[model samples]
Target: MNDMAYGALLPETPREFGFFVDGAWRAGHDWFTRTSPSHDIPVTRIARCTTDDLDAAVAAARRAFENRSWAGLPGAERAGILLRTAEGLRRRRDEIAYWEVLENGKPLTQARGEIDHCIACFEVAAGAARLMHGDSFNNLGDSLLGLTLREPIGVVGLITPWNFPFLILCERVPFILASGCTLVVKPAEVTSATTLILADILAEAGLPGGVYNVVTGAGRTIGQALADHPDVDMLSFTGSTAVGRSCVHASADSNLKKLGLELGGKNPIVVFADANLHDAADAVAFGIGFNTGQCCVSSSRLIVERSVAREFETILADKMAKIRVGDPFDPQTQIGAITTQAQNDTIMGYIAQGQKEGAKLLFGGRALDLGRGHFIQPTLFSDLTPSMAVGREEIFGPVLSSFHFDTTEQAIALANDTVYGLAASLWTRDIDRALTVTRRVRAGRFWVNTIMAGGPETPIGGFKQSGWGRESGLLGVEEYTQVKSVHIETGGRTHWIAS
Candidate 1:
């Protein structure tokens, strides 16, 4: 009934954490159990869906799209469903948030915030359904009436990641629905429960059967099917750049499906000497440390002016040390356990690489065991060169690598050095400098004097190898629909081909 009771009221392992297909919950022929990141206990025995299962889910989505049962619903009706879905998520927020903490190994506070954002994604997308529009073209000439029709791209396959699973789904699925497309979702195996719960809530909210299907398993089998399925029109994936490349290739080999990928980031945050030192320090700490630095837009690289580098690093290290790394369920905890042993290894490996590359380890590289959970102290590195692995690569963990820059040009150069252009931040008192730096940075999302500042309304994605296609905003809504241009002879046809 209340907040604290939710941890008990919510199931640690649900009786049925199965696939949702054709408006019903079903299990796969095979299954695998997930041990919690918060604590190494059984979270759920998730369905180990093969390509065959993926095929069935895709078929369901295809049928729904072809039948126009869900996809053909009027925008207003669709909007109503989306709005109701948002409300449904609201009702189950605490439960879902708890699960996020358990599975993701993020603090409960951060999990709650993610839940709020997820709710916002659906609510904003409800409005997007009505706002999806095409343009009228009169410049083509008065004799011809020309316009474009924006229509859904048919069945879409969604492959989401473990980090921010609920938020990514909300970012993707709602917009896909808003554009009148049916979905076949493959959530990350580590965090499949929340999505299953979401499917159930959608059913309760009266979502049409077969409109939103789920197939859970390893990304290799399930996600590969989605990418390569001939029936799937689009593949929206959020994961690492390497996996995203695989999705592209798979799509090319099979359906040649449209792709919406929100991939990995080695994002940069620059703090000029003119900026407020404390404020800059705060942003830097939170940017790299929030969600345990397991975000596409995590400001993992901080480029500070050489004049203030020492002071900033001291303040930043102090803030990082203050971050409480403990049980995710504890509301007072700032940093939770590493999501999985594999991720913990990856983080520690990166730390080792940073050391190997001669980056100065300023603070925290020790791993701790919080009961059975895999825990690590927040890691920090200074005197990092552009060529260093720590500075260039994306280590999706609670790690921060700092660099010193003497001039704006050097700062911009350092920020833009990486192949990934997912997101970046700049902290400066000068608005002019902020604007200039923002324009120069190649990332899709840029935060001036702020870090990881965006909501459901703000578009988020990457440029280079980080991945493509934006999420949220009107642009995000537009990404799900294809445009068809039409021309009609109103007065008479004027041929430009011949006289």
Candidate 2:
């Protein structure tokens, strides 16, 4: 392979761009230029989907489902197709990685790792198809037989975010297809190229036309139409809490379809006095700064024990200072450019809010100078309180807010005080203390002595306002299927008495 292709394996770029719909490449109504945040240059121009385009895509998905091209396929056959797609993704890992880096503005190394994770998601979903078995209860009461079966929910509308576009799409689509459902995916306009390219890979892997569709456009237009489309059986979305709420409201106008939303989070990392300071610092850094803190499950709030708070802040600031920030294509860069200029402005606004809230800015508080790219310094704040907007809200940027707590009880209280309960991390050596905090923290995923460590085996979702339903693992497969109970009377008949 040439160096470009080889680097593609490590996260580079695709040779060309196109949108995949009904297993074919079709030009959209208009094109929108995607600019590289690291270089401030046009990466590629993608199809700017219109409302009519979304209607067409959803109609195609509905036809594919009604015709049973996917839903009627045998589980084993569907499983084989998904497995083949996973294999195809593995073979072109470098290409996918490169496309991800170019489109998503994540560091090359992180983009490559995300590509591997995406492959793993498909593989796991493929295997999960066989495990989608139901229960058969014979002879429940001498003459009655009962059986429970699972079937796919037709025509899933998958709306993914820009931060981890490929990973999020894999998390939703593979499982939906594995459960024998067709999908109409609308990736974020700013980062739709990688997903559209994957559509080509899936088509090559033998996914039937209309079984999977990609519609690219801004959320206000195409996204809203998809959510409100009466034909879509379910909607799976991952983005900001405000938009998630809008989706929920819009769904109410349609069929009130099954919804899965992974929304915003101001996830907390509570470090106790007994915690390993060095390890805590490193884990906290990864939690908040990974993906430039654009992740929904980011541990943005640090509730540290007052006894070790000062020292932990020092360690964290020193660590933040060392993160290499630059171009997304640079292998040595740890933090890549922000995804867009608007996102950069949003993050900077939050940094200013942190200062206005009286939180002490410890270190790294300004946007970086990486040519004309959208780069922000990894920021850390001290003297943060639970009542402050910086501590309560989801910034979705590379900003960390540290709150001091005097006791473990106080730490747990502060951690659970937010409207979001997506994920949280606890750093302590005591096993019993970890268990105690785990029980009290109202999050879907909890980490002890670690932060954001998992593979496809772990199920991911949120609690309360973090949104409903689960994704990944066997539970993820269940999300796409509906359960029905069949009851039969062999020797007896039931009668109702008149009142």
Candidate 3:
């Protein structure tokens, strides 16, 4: 995973890799192969870990935590290792970015940008570690003093999704490490390639044995095992809301492990008549088109002021027409392959549902045969009502449902109509409207004039079924720690002690 070795993988064809556990790379009981979504051919054969592997990885993490090998470290010491991890990621940025193209099919340029963001995530989490402090108060009697301490929450289990494998791991793992919690990671089986590389990156950066471990396999197996293990103190997962519900249930059925789920989002992008039409259109395109709109925060809903709806649709269609959809290895490919054939089918079903519901098809809306992998064109639906299945459900693809509103209140209503509340972007030149609209939007991240804004410094999660708990920033670090209170008697020992 070192930068010098990056060149070796760029001509990157299918390669076989093993899981990393207890600071050692090991093969699984069986194996699973993942095909390159762009090439529609096998590109990776990964270890399919069984229950025994899960036990071993989690046991290692438990030993590390209980031994205080990592949890007992001072904030500065933990921060140092986290910083090293960040540096390690920076060094291997190129190779890892390219691997993402092969494994996840994000465009090379976007993958590179995501790698940069990953580095920032570690750096920011490192900063948050230094800021992990508790408060002191003396509201009691003069002889009494109160203090609080933030302690690492013991071993944590992480299950990340494939849509942005590197991105989600960077978002979760750094904070967990910075909080001094040992972890057992179960990245999505379809895209475990870069995560395996990350295992090497972390170990090379000097993370102690058992302090960080990775297991690859089906989520129902390794992921469920991690969730059910009594030793795991917390579980952080990123995926669909249905799967998120299952995570919650597993936690409840097990030791009631603390759960942090960053789940599904049918996010909305609102445009006002006063906004710059072209700029709004471009932002909408980027929002839905990024990662082929596989992101939880993808703006699948476009609610525009009626006066600007027709014009905005025209501009967005033009932008979609200009997008390049082809091989992921090509740096110019704006939209690469969908993560799997099943996912492509699901998206197509949603498009057909839109058509059946009488929504107008403004632009693209069909599966493309690029002669290799799962590819879908950027799609748009017009005159969609809030109640349409396409507008209400999480398609998790490059599909946008278009709606219109005559007033700001109506626009807000349209945006808030979904079950999801992960993110929303508002476009308006009016400062009052921008502030008001963004504030009123029920989303974890609210963007004004700009869509998909924010970085590692900002916290992201969701409201309602989008899932709970924040990731990134100081809030993220807090999710991995438990607070304990201590009181001391400074004046004199009370007679009640003897009594």
- C-alpha lDDT score of every prediction, in listed order: 0.85, 0.86, 0.88
TM-score to native of every candidate shown: 0.95, 0.95, 0.96
| Residue 86's lDDT in candidate 1 | 90
| lDDT per residue (tens digit) for residues 1-499 in model 2 | 3233213432233234566678788876688888777666566678887878778888888888888988887778888888899888888887777667777789888987887888888888888987898888975987888999998988899999999989899888888888888899999988887888788889988988999999988888988988999999999999888999988888898898989999889899999999889999999988888999999988899999998899999999989888888777767888888898888998999899889989999988899886667889999988876678877888889899998889778988989988999999999989898999999999999999988989887799999899889999989999989999999778645668654
Query: How do the candidates rank by TM-score, highest first?
Result: 3, 1, 2
**Model 3 residue 70 lDDT score:** 80
Q: Name the lDDT value of residue 78 in candidate 3.
A: 77
Clashing pairs in 2: 8-94, 9-94, 11-97, 11-98, 12-98
lDDT by residue for model 3 over 1-499, one digit each (tens)? 3112222333334588888888998976688988777766567889998888889999999998899888777778778878898899888998888678878878888898998899999889888888899889889778888999889999999999999999999999999898989999999999998988988888887788998889999998888888889889999999999999998999999899999999899898999989989999999998999999999999999999999789889999999989898777676789988988788899999999999999999999988887667899999999876679988899999999889999999988888887889999998889988888878889999998898878988899999899989999999998899999999888667587666
Give the Å error, residue 189, model 1. 0.8
Q: Among these predicted structures, which one has the highest TM-score?
A: 3
For lDDT, the strongest prediction is 3
Please write out the lDDT profile of model 1 over residues 1-499, one tens digit for every residue: 2123224343445444779888888766777877767666666778888777788888888888999997678889999999999999999998888777767788888888888888899889999898888989888766777899999989989989998888888888888889999999999998888988899888888899999999998887777777889999998999999999999899889968899988889889999999999998888888877888888888999899999899989998998889888877776788787887888899999999999989999989888765567888888899977788888888999889998999888889989999899989999999889989999999998988777777888888899998888889778888988999998777656688997
lDDT of 3 at 365: 92
